[model samples]
Target: MNVSLTSEPLRPVVQTRPVPPALIEALSQRFGKQLSLAQVVREQHGRDESSFSVPPPDAVVFAESAQDVSDAVKLAAQYKVPVIPFGAGSSVEGHLLAVQGGISIDVGRMNQVLAIHAEDLTVTVQPGVTRKALNEAVKSTGLFFPIDPGADASIGGMCATRASGTNAVRYGTMRENVLALDVVTASGELIHTGTRAKKSSAGYDLTRLMVGSEGTLGILTEITLKLYPLPEAVMAATCSFASLAEAVNATIQIIQMGVPIARCELLDAVTVRMVNTHSKLSLPESALLLMEFHGSPAGVQEQVETVQAIAAEFGGDTFEWAHTPEERTRLWTARHNAYFAGVQSRPGCKVISTDACVPISRLADALLDSVLETQASGIPYFMVGHVGDGNFHMGYLIDPNSPEERATAEQLNHQLVRRALALGGTCTGEHGVGLHKKGFLLEETGVGAVAMMRAIKTALDPDNILNPGKIFEL
Candidate 1:
């Protein structure tokens, strides 16, 4: 944690490779209408929620099945053209950008609940199934998938980033829940990793390796994930704090004391104001911790009591309970839409959202200064955190035309990442090292460690054709 990182890099430069005319003709023949060389389709598949705007892919393949993905990838592999996997384009760190020109294989149509073993508490689903869709499919069976990254992102994208969200304090991320994967390697060879069993001492953890590879290694086609029984009792509450420090400190104590709270999210006063106007609710215009507890009624009550006392120690307001399903849904919906709320707060502003996470004990140290620095910089921003597990994000709303504003936001972000690394945390907790964080990845993992990763990528993808120019330069 003491080592200093090199200077963070700017936005990735586009490095488009040539797309063979014969390749396009072959794809047109193979996929017919499913293959699109149209500009709009290519643009739609090439972009995501990130601010970076690169040229669109040369073409897009609307892959509806695993075979379609394999075939498209096989053809691209032959030419060593980049093959970028496109799902629900919800990544904020430029994961979906087509920096190196190629064809985007959009798997949005590959959405189906393949199998459900409610008794075994597991479900197999297609790659393009959204988290909400997966939860809906199993809701009747009293089971749910808890990894909600706020954007209803595709399960395949979530697996690519190893995403976690509000409920991660308890249920964990895709890395923990995903039991197996059907993947198409760079060669377009379909291979299976892991199994549906609860535990496995498999020869190599290919499943884990692929989970957060950011598509530099392979593309996920189908995923089998662990599910949890619906909680018998669920209670939601919001407690306002005097400052961000108090809210974060209270969360630290709750986590340190071993509480099993399902969700603990923090939103700054600025964000609360934005949410108030956006969601049409009158929440206290102050720093707040939104919490949810799930268990038996008595158990939930005990957790509520414990967290309330801990919160009170930090001058938190009396808990505002959301006891009904409608009430809980509304509150969570607003929190999930916090990004949009922030964006709408400033018209014509683009967001550069930062993902920095530190150790539980260092949460206060890591966040308080960043908040002060960002506020002092005079940039419009909204802050939020999953502080129970030491992960937080700040969305800096910058005028895309103003290079000065963008540079200031970048500096603040660079400092924040440095602080997090110094405090025994990661450059990114959930957001993987995409085109934006390639420099930080090296800073956090070091030259030797990243060399190992590059070696693995080369071993799995000799031509660097799968999601090329992402994670790191080849």
Candidate 2:
């Protein structure tokens, strides 16, 4: 009649609340064929480019309008079921995973360029629109959005991550580009923040708050982004260096001297080798810097000349120029695909990407130490960075099944993050503190700051249904 207890301590049980049958029925009737419970669809909505194991949502709702998003959130709130907003599915930090089981509200169907104000230098778009699409949409007007995060990431996704890319050094990240937003709050209420105006000293900075909230506080339906006029002249080039330290030092000098380089990227020797093989280029297998200058012909020439002198001071060679637009696209395409090239270089290996940003003055030391430490570990890794902005990525290739390899990569990442923090930098420059950097966020921001963040989350989403378990655990 009596049962004996095991000596081992019982693991804490995870309480999973199931979606209410009536709510599911209501959603099915409301969304009709737009709601999908298919396993394939749910699985696809569950994971992103991250190495995290797939945890599919209970259902997927393809929202085509802001009202659809509002209705879905209302239904989820009524049932107390998690609601995860999804865009292009291009995130690499496990931001899209349904860790606590939920319904994914797919906003990709809402893709549209609502309005473009060429004179005002602003564009309004649905959250589902991708960066490439927006650029093409605005190409005719001789203006473009500059927040290119490598991937053709959706505007909503990029805004949620506060993404920045190579051009960020000149045009800034989403935090600066986004002028206004239409957000669907956790309680299913729609609110507008900011306006088409260039600057506003209005009450609370809600626009900035929702820009990088990762859909926890609200779902972005529409975004108004700042645009820049297309430069009259553009030049792209690559310079080779004897060592990573030299390359980074050259970048530091360029920034220190106030050179207006549009894009400045760094690729370690290993990364260049991979890029050569995968991109079919003959780049030298050495530390390299890829740069782009945007301005009038004379201005571009001046900037290039100054950067060339700086590079020469650090033992850099003459730049290999991509003179034509096609050539420039080809070169930047290769740079953007560096992560894929690194993965392809190591057959059957998965990448564990690390992002760290340090002050410009300390970038050289931080990068040099990271390279040495990672190399000492004997792990296959590829390094690339938006050096102009003091942000970089190191993708460590490892067999996902090998715990030893994972541990080695983790150790390298930990050391690099600690070094960055010591240098008065952030653990992640552009990538949000998704599931991957939750612990690092705590370390970077003290307990009090994190507590304040949690308080904000609680105040906005009392039921904790929106993208649960992201940034931090409630």
Candidate 3:
């Protein structure tokens, strides 16, 4: 049962310094039949998602443990080879792009749950463990790690990007869930940041500093994550509106009312249409809102009633409920496949899915203005978002070869970032400041903060060997 991944394409061989035969021999001798320079290019090269920036690494090494990562870092440091940590390869931003090509440390082989302290409500896992795998492993214990971020992204990459998803409205992002991390620093020394003691008043929070660093500061090897008890009662509902503004306004009201939503997403008319066409669903060509509630049955019902009343005030239509697990899965599957559905709408064009998060009160205005701006530019886009968290993604379609369309899409993206920042929100909510959002980071975080970050980067990675030319272009 060989399941070939459709995302992996045969990219043209990009130019980079070739790994020396002597170095390859050294690696081969060290790993004993487990290392090869040729296999790295074929297997662990490019990303699994959209196209963005530069090429893949010169070589790849499959890391099996923390020591393996440290050893690889030590070798890369000695040889002046750039090391880009590879997890599930699911980053939309080009965080894994080997701009200054060297060795890509593939951490997928290190997939393991080292410990599950159910009583403590924290689980320790290697960098390679996927979120879905982690959740499944802990399901029987009535606990789950809820920072979703759409894809089955690796725990390490999720931490790198500081990801948040559908459940972030309730459970929070990786910034809050990650308790500790075992990282191999730029100097090839292993260090642990944070503790599993629920709270810490320690000096300088290095744990959070690495959370959204996007593999620039260090290579994550192990993570300790807080878990939540599986909800005793859950309900999923979908509501539609004639206009997206109506749906968004209703969401704003729901949040203002403190309805305690577990998940709330907005789907614009274009997105609904795309999903209907690609996923073969009979959804109306109107804006839609999907909401989920989790708690005691009585508490969930009370919250749902409040949300329903708010929706009615804002022209929201009849709510439909998914009563079964299969139905709920099918509902969320359409949401998860938004990027695929949107890209499929335009032939020969891949998606440039960018995210921006604005304040809850300003979400409707920012999104509506963005829609108008995009429409005025005649660019095709699909809008989907975690409305409760005020974080939305605009999936723009552009021909891979057309510079005109790429420029147009980029302009729209920049405008979205500016609007999000002006509205007192972040340019990127989940996706870190990889190559794509570096300019926006400058605009949002300002010169002083960015300089401090760059100084930290320099202090940690003086040689600039780890993920060179990413985030801040020092």
Candidate 4:
């Protein structure tokens, strides 16, 4: 599984354009207390959870409504300044960085659940609403939003990244769940795409386009998403395996057999050990598979039996069930905290997290190769995977002041991405191409496709003021 390493040359940094003082003054006069020029506030708006160097925005605007967002965009367009949209700041791919030094429009104040169509299994909300909040709001209706990306990310941010999580194997990602959006274009005009209906023969499918555009096309102000009914019966369990391949193979077999697994996650021995220490649990420090089944009681039992047989064939140990709701929450919370646990495992070290996905059959090859290479790289790292969907992430711990460590991590990322592409997979699965994977986009999609994307950017934004220097540079 180990592969030779080759370093890819880093892209040269493009100089950021300066913001106009007149625009800042005008915004200051209009927004008054809502506008902040404080150094700490600008710094807060500049970065997300990524290890990328922070480049704080020139100013931060606390937007409270669609009008606020529209007005800010219009002003930025007038002054030809970059507009970086800020959400929960949970993005790990440098999506929220103010790379071009513009005004960041903070939408956290606009959080609101607009409407819930319980009968139709759909809900509309302002972009700032978090997934947890949305679920709490609709809990009384015997329904819930299933798209959980680990973080309590803002709906706007989740849509921007087209995020998915452990449950994506069954429930799907944001791309499939989001039905409509009210977007503020580069010119500050609000336009609606798609509708509340379940199906549509839309003209341009602009809704899909904007879903993962990474704020380059427009700023999402309102979102309409599909919801699911709470399962009648739910069960979660963890199984230990002698090796990583065995765990991954068991998952592959379960998936290929068409078992309706609600969630199928793989955590390597290193990750499991970190989670155990961080979460104060006694999970065996072996390659592990965490699974969830959802259906009628009979259906759930059937799935558990099928999965148990599959796991046994791969030498997996007995399943340890989380019988109660509180136990299930604790299990998932530990899984979601894998990144932070990895960070805490190494004091004073920052993490460079990256993800890739391939066909279900290629999951083992991709993950094994990555794990082997990382182990040989002499880097401190933790690995986790959503094996049913063939997506996984590795977080490399490094000292922030060490350029050599940063370069090594970047090289490891380049090798992993190239391997994924060779296996007919994407450079990114859920995490969108922000600043980190811009070069790899051209490699995954050909020049012609990338050129078409650039053309679309030009045609829509024209001025290149909306989230400038992201995805593919103009």
Off by over 4 Å in 4: 1-14
Model 1 TM-score? 0.99
> All candidates' lDDT scores?
0.92, 0.90, 0.84, 0.90
Give lDDT for model 4: 0.90
CA deviation > 4 Å runs, candidate 2? 1-16
Error of 2 at 255 (Å): 0.3
lDDT of 2 by residue, 82-170 (tens): 99999999898878888778799999989999999999999999999999999999999999898889788999999999999989999
**Most lDDT-accurate candidate:** 1
Query: Residue 259's C-alpha lDDT in candidate 1?
Result: 93
Q: How do the residues 105-186 of candidate 1 rate in per-residue lDDT, one tens digit apiece? A: 9999999999999999999999899999999999999999999998999999999999999999999988899999999999
For model 1, the local distance difference test gives 0.92
At residue 159, candidate 4 shows an lDDT of 98
Best first by lDDT, ranked: 1, 4, 2, 3
Among the numbered candidates, top TM-score falls to: 1
Better of 1 and 2 by TM-score: 1
For residues 321-397, write the lDDT of model 4, one tens digit per residue.
99999999999999999988998999989888778998989888888989999999999999999888999998999
Model 3 C-alpha lDDT per residue in residues 42-151, reported as the tens digit of each score: 34565647566466566778889888888878877877678888899988877887767777888998899999999999999999999989998999899999888778
TM-scores of the models, in the order given: 0.99, 0.96, 0.94, 0.97
